[model samples]
Target: MFFKLQSLALIFLGFNAYASPLAEPNEVHISERGAGLNSFLNLLLSYLPAIDTSVTDATGIITDFDNLLGALTGAQETYNELGRSCTEWTVIFARGTAEPGNVGVLVGPPLFDALDDKFGSSAITIQGVNDYSASVQGYLAGGDSNGSAEMARQIRAAKSQCPHTKLIASGYSQGCQIVHKAIAQLDSATASWISSVLLFGDPLKGQALNSVPSSRVFTACHALDDICKNGILIGPSHLTYAVDVVNAVNFAAAH
Candidate 1:
């Protein structure tokens, strides 16, 4: 029992290892995780290859084990709501540093599920910021230039193509830095399309979101979340932001 808890603790605690800040991120690091835990994560993800997010069932809530794992592992990584008959809202998300997949496993999936459950799948589109690597060096350097540019391009494309969807830009950890940089790249016209901005464990917490109004933005920095103060701790507090999803979602929906 202790082993299980310790294993999870290690996974979160291993994040923000300053010693190897420049190494490329791989599943938070393929070698850093034990073989047993790796196998367990793989098996857990295999049962539900597609998160089926953005299309909630009659129950309208994610309750299954595999389904919940889907949210944790970023199974909704493929959810892109563009090119559909209608898109009332569009969410462009950047995952944390070292997290696997474009959306990352930690925060992206749960956010997708919450938006889906609240707004209904048909009303929203969630797109992962695939253009960025979410690299460690990028986090240490404030933000990756290329990643920031790519995210801005995506935000512009989403709003330009749909022309009607309310845009939401979101990020976690290093992803938050990219969000900050990306927003800076936007012109006044493109910036106005952003209906809401969500930042979790933001490294640039106090810094304003260039053109986005404070009333339309929601930032969550849990107690002891060193990242909020520009520290890269990635502590247990950082992992607990999932608990704030309901409030964050409500905040987003309001805008």
Candidate 2:
């Protein structure tokens, strides 16, 4: 949430730098600014191990690799398409605190794009909660009441409108608090409509997600993520959830 100007700029610029050769015009852009050089270095390092071990021919790198990076790139945009029509999946994602747009840039859009690549664009519908302010004050209150209600409203509608769709609830940072609040507001039967839950940098990290079973939920909290820990210490670790996209995607996709 507190991304320094230089760090945020460098994170995306580095991606653009390396990806530019393989990417088309505006093809290698990042949506929202993210945590600075650490995020860039982490992503770079992830590929390094793979490159050293398996990628003998760099030219042989395939579209899947590009697709993965592309998924994490986008413009700050708000979408409210979930439950618009019955589809294979309905994904409702909330952006982190103070993040712009409904879905936010850091994690929501990337997750949407990644899922789209996996199951085709038409196979799923993704929506972000634009009605919520995503304010820090709201997070301190254990999530804004209005935001929680709005998210709950979407959950109710998604299930009623598309009974068979696999409804997934996901959020990052304070967004995770909203998910917990919204689900708690619902009755057991209604809450059970959610197929899976994915949370990153959760403030309520170790706590149960009310009616949602632990088996169906996955919370990605880095050891250094202060938000996920006991005390309040907002470090760069809290903002680097972009690193967990692959694992988050796999968990949501499987369930």
Candidate 3:
């Protein structure tokens, strides 16, 4: 009995050492990071008129939504262009924080390629966030709030339009916060359609983990990546996710 207790105590200590304060959902305060610049900018932006964000289509392309009529027209045009009716594709919406096109160029291609390779066809479309701003302000406020809302709207719209579509939500850094917020707001019916959630270097990893089921969620954080280890401290470590993308693809393929 004493030996058993000793073993258990050692296991507990090991677990604690491996865990970060970020492992606690409520322990890490996102608002407390970085002198409140993000929060202040968010407040300033609140006073301005709202802008149309973006929407995704069956082909996993994200288009700008200029207005109500424009968005509708754009969606229809995209659907038609992609030959929407004949082929079934799994949609993967990927968002990256602070970088203009890093998500598409860096993290998106590998995952998309993997999915295509595994499925033996171009079975996946990656819709990257176009309006993503790489600013400290945007990071704190969860990227663009309007953009995030629009993403949620598009997810619902796509699901309604294509009931057979499979959805995957993915993000990196502050983009993970956007994905988490958007997913949380999804209705049960829409959320149920989500097959997987992939997050890399997520700032709110612990809180985001609780928003979705463990079986459908996968995350990767580099050991030396301060952004994942801490929050939003930029370095070369946080910039790469080649291995993580491979793991994500494997996870998605299995599911």
Best by lDDT: 2
Best by TM-score: 2
Better of 2 and 3 by lDDT: 2
Q: Give the residue spans of candidate 1 off by over 4 A.
A: 1-74, 83-85
Query: Could you tell which candidate, 1 or 3, scores higher by TM-score?
Result: 1
RMSD in angstroms, candidate 1?
12.7
Could you give candidate 2's per-residue lDDT for residues 67-119 as a string of tens digits?
Answer: 23333432445788964779998888887776666877657765665676567
Residue 162 lDDT in candidate 2: 92
Relative to the true structure, how large is the alpha-carbon lDDT of every model?
A: 0.66, 0.67, 0.50
TM-score computed on alpha carbons, candidate 3: 0.61
Point out where model 2 deviates above 4 Å.
1-73
TM-score of each candidate structure, all chains considered together:
0.71, 0.71, 0.61
Instruction: For residues 1-255, write the lDDT of model 1, one tens digit per residue.
Output: 123556545543442131122121221222322333344334433332222222112111212332334433436444555555548888888887766567765577667767776787778877777767666677888988887997898898887788888888999888899999999999978886799998888988878887788888899887566778887444445544554555678898898
Question: Which residue pairs in candidate 3 collide?
Answer: 98-134
